[model samples]
Target: MTEAPATIMLNGKSRKIKQPCSATELLSELGWKPTQVVIEHNGQVIPRSETGAIMLREGDQVEIILPVAGG
Candidate 1:
């Protein structure tokens, strides 16, 4: 039997992703550049170096924050 897609809360919205994927893959899927945003997974800040190693699971809450540019 095939496994159901993983559903996660992304930026306060519900997003369904095919299977469990790494945070890096999630970023790519969303067309987001890792260097341009800060990732908070399950209420904890995830370091850029560990983004590739962290696996996204069903029901996980992810918050993506974009940095603001100022003059």
Candidate 2:
């Protein structure tokens, strides 16, 4: 079987995920809702629809910023 693409970092660590994946798919894999997390690629906020359109590649920097409610 062919190898999948290398993992993209969540914050500063390497993340290993199978290939043929998109931003939406990644969130699904983590069991997180699109509303719960914010995705930043190359320092840009990508829209939800763009998730499916944006295919991940090796050495790509992905920062998944999420919100937490607390008082």
Candidate 3:
């Protein structure tokens, strides 16, 4: 039997993602680059260098913020 996809709370919305996904992988799946945004996992800000090491679990809360160019 196939395993159910993991569900995470992304930006306050429910999103289904593959199992064993890392923060970096999530970014890739969302068509985003690591350098282009900041990530907050479970209410904590995740450093860019640590994104690859952080694994995303079901019910995880993630917030992705992109830097604005305008003043």
Candidate 4:
């Protein structure tokens, strides 16, 4: 039997992933560099060191904040 895909809210948009993946995997899938943004998983801040072990679940809300440079 095939497992159901996991659905998560990314940057306020609904997204469906093939399977449950860690935050690190998610970033890589999105083509984002770990140092380019700050991650907030399920309303809590996720440190870079912990991202690799943090498994994203269905219905999880993720906020990726990117720094802007302007004067």
Candidate 5:
């Protein structure tokens, strides 16, 4: 099995991704909408418009937290 290229903490869980991809790349790859997901980098929240311009570094911590439709 191929090892992961990047490791990020997602909601207290460690996620190993294929590579250090931008938020836009990751979201599109996962079939998620940038507008619907909340993306945080190093505890700082970023807007959806920034996703495409932000470049990810190795060992960088990315948090993807989203809101659910439930009461």
Candidate 6:
């Protein structure tokens, strides 16, 4: 049998990940560059330097916002 996926709330939507992973890894998997985005984990803002250290958990809430440039 395979391991059940972990579920987390991402940007108000539910998402399933294969396993628990660092916030950095999750961002990488989603094709996001840590330096270009802001991450909020469980209602706490995560600094870019700490992204690699924050491990994601099941039922956790995460919000990722990318910077927009307009002229």
Best by lDDT: 3
| Candidate no. 1 TM-score | 0.88
Tell me the spans in candidate 1 whose CA falls farther than 4 Å from its real position.
Answer: none
Model 4 earns a TM-score of: 0.88
Model 6: colliding residue pairs: none
Is candidate 5 or 6 superior in TM-score? 6
Off by over 4 Å in 2: 1-3
Q: Estimate each model's TM-score.
A: 0.88, 0.79, 0.89, 0.88, 0.72, 0.86
* Candidate 3 residue-wise lDDT, 6-32, digit = tens: 999999999998888899999998899
Q: What is the lDDT of residue 6 in candidate 3?
A: 94
Tell how far residue 41 is off in model 6, in angstroms.
Answer: 0.3
Report lDDT (Cα) of residue 11, candidate 6: 95
Off by over 4 Å in 4: none
Cα-lDDT of candidate 4: 0.88
Cα displacement (angstroms), candidate 5, residue 25, comes to 1.0
Distance from true position, residue 34, model 5, in Å? 0.6
lDDT of 6: 0.91
> Residue 60 in model 5: shift from native, Å?
2.1
What's the TM for model 2? 0.79
lDDT by residue for model 2 (1-71), tens: 86677777767789887786788888888898877788897678998767778777777788888777878
Q: Write the per-residue lDDT of candidate 6 for residues 13-59, one digit (tens) a residue.
A: 99998665889999999999999899999999999999999988899
Error of 6 at 16 (Å): 0.4
